[model samples]
Target: MGGEGENMTEDAKDPVTYEFRDGAAWITLADAEHGNALNEVGAAALWRAIQRARADRAPVVVLSAEGRFFSVGGDLASFAAADDVSAYIDDLADALHRIVSELMRLDAVVISVVRGTAAGAGFPLAAAADLVLAARSARFTLGYTKVGLTVDGGTSLLSATLGLHHALHLALLNPVLSAEEAHRAGLVAQVHDDDELDAAVDRVVAQLVTGSHAAQVTVKRLLRGAATPAPETALRREALAIREAAARPDGQEGVRAFLEKRTPVFPGDR
Candidate 1:
């Protein structure tokens, strides 16, 4: 888990954009049309962006997305199209977990600015950060149950941080929670009205950059150590569970139903 292999070669067409300036590294998800859905390619690009921030020793890293969604999580269309859906989903899960692991180990203050929906794997993607700043328009949900897949991207570990009741509710009912709801549930650090979210994030960035970097980093490590286990094992469990689920009849019908824009008739229904 030290390193998640070399990142994909940087390309102009990658779905993530990384830029370092003013002591902060900005990593923006750029695949708006697809809602920045996590796939192997997008995951690798995101990994590269995280690695770049690490290389630069940025004091603060801001993770944001250009799309209406922070990310829609796994791309169901791709899942349905995969000739080997289980293998494909396993690979995607691994790729995303790699990113989550890196974020957990990163020295900088990792902040995710969520403006819209953060569903499925997206929930953990935002929650993995050291801080989550969200807009009033933001929403959070697991969404995995809807598609008959288990949670991945460190959700299994991260959800522990969110407490059992909240996690159970999300994993079971798949209800969408607003940013204020997320804040109330201790899932987000701050929530501003949509128009003011960027300004709020900028202010937080300034404070993080100007504060005692060493102290903050040490606190990050200390709190994380006390809060949860290493992300690798829990994440691996999620990845494996997802793969097995994806190979089952419920997973098959669920993914197909999602892609077909219809209600999923899960195994229990039959």
Candidate 2:
């Protein structure tokens, strides 16, 4: 479709790749030399691309990586090079936390398509997504504790997403789970063959775009914040969203289309 869409390259070291196609944006870790490791340059590049995606009005975002490794996580060499090692680590940690939190805050739905190994911060990157599609060849684990490092980048929030006991197990045990096992444990939503991973991600993006933009954003906000908000606050948030939806033209069209037995023509739709 549309000649496979445009693949825009960003100029930055360490290979942080991102592309915008149709209504979806894809960001893949391109640092194959280091097993797509998350170095300071790579992390900063990703953060910048994400901001670009937000500004571009993309309806959906997908995260993946080139090579056999999705990401091996942090770059120890970079940390070792810093003059103030502890301060550098703290700053890096803060950046990662902001990145993770922003993934949920972005209006569009974000999905992670994992193939091969996704460990440490990489695992949490997938977890922070609105949805995750993993290839049968994929593996997930928490590699932080094994490396004598505490988890960061909203690892606690990822644990909350996967539930307390399982989250604790991932952190403490650090055992790798195959894509099938991940799906079974509710960590991944869909699993496909290695050859079919790209198509599967496209299918998800297509399904995501079927909903009106407003509805998608509203649902994303609700789901992202619901578990963290107070009961009364959550209810109020939902009610406010409902009121906004009812006021949108698509909302009225949806109701009228249901009554008239015809499809609703949403605004900004081609």
Candidate 3:
């Protein structure tokens, strides 16, 4: 495993921080104050970090976050404050989708380490990774509907990964799945004790870095090709749906209520 070095990017000050170590790239969501939510700036920074990781051609990329939460999803406070909600969502989706695309297309293996909660767009972020390692206490949810928003971050891929019925169940019910449940549903590749997570992740990365990089890359590409609906197509649909939902009255109310720490009274709630 690679030790952290001082080769941090200039944009390391952003909510998303990037560090290159040995043969791996470590991308951490550092905005713990807000549950590591992705605002427009964070989204853009993450996209750029992903691009840098690909350019570095690291054999392994580890995505993790500071604080208890992996991420609570997009920053709804930012969304509620935007003058043009639709445009705001479109921009967010654009950056996030690019990040997802890069993760899928990169020759290196992408790993997501989930600790606390992964919700909304966060769910897709974890699901997009080639391997997801979750702490025993970690939880997952597709929380889009709670905020009257639709899915983004290439969640359409979930249909293929979790099957149509299970995917729809998640999308509609928004139940939080524990690490064990997530692994059973194929969302997480492995679960580790909270205390052992870092070591477990390091072990996996060590194995990858020590193995045949070319063979790993070839296998990844082959498996991705075998998946249906094409990542590009799924991303496009997700972007459009998110934009449309953000423009709805219910979406607006939901975001506002969330930021205000109140129950959302969506249209027809009365």
Which candidate has the highest TM-score of all?
Answer: 3
Question: Which of candidates 1 and 2 reaches a greater TM-score?
Answer: 1
- Local accuracy of candidate 2 as per-residue lDDT tens digits, 115-142: 8999877887777788999999999988
Give the per-residue Cα lDDT of candidate 3 at 188. Answer: 93
- Candidate 2 clashes between residue pairs 3 or more apart in a chain or in different chains: none
| lDDT of candidate model 1 versus the reference | 0.87
Q: After superposition, how far is residue 81 of candidate 3 from its true place, in Å?
A: 1.2
Question: Which ten-residue region of model 1 has the weakest summed lDDT?
Answer: 1-10
- Which runs of model 3 end up more than 4 angstroms from their true locations? 1-4, 9-13, 268-270
Candidate 1 has a TM-score of 0.93
**For model 2, how big is the CA root-mean-square deviation?**
18.5
lDDT of 3 by residue, 149-221 (tens): 8888887788888899999999988999999999999879999999999999999999999999999999999
Q: Tell me the TM-score of each prediction against the true structure.
A: 0.93, 0.80, 0.94
Colliding pairs, model 3: none
lDDT of 1 by residue, 174-224 (tens): 999999888988889999989998889989999999999999999999988
Off by over 4 Å in 1: 1-13, 268-270
lDDT, candidates in the order shown? 0.87, 0.72, 0.87
At residue 249, what lDDT does model 1 achieve?
Answer: 88
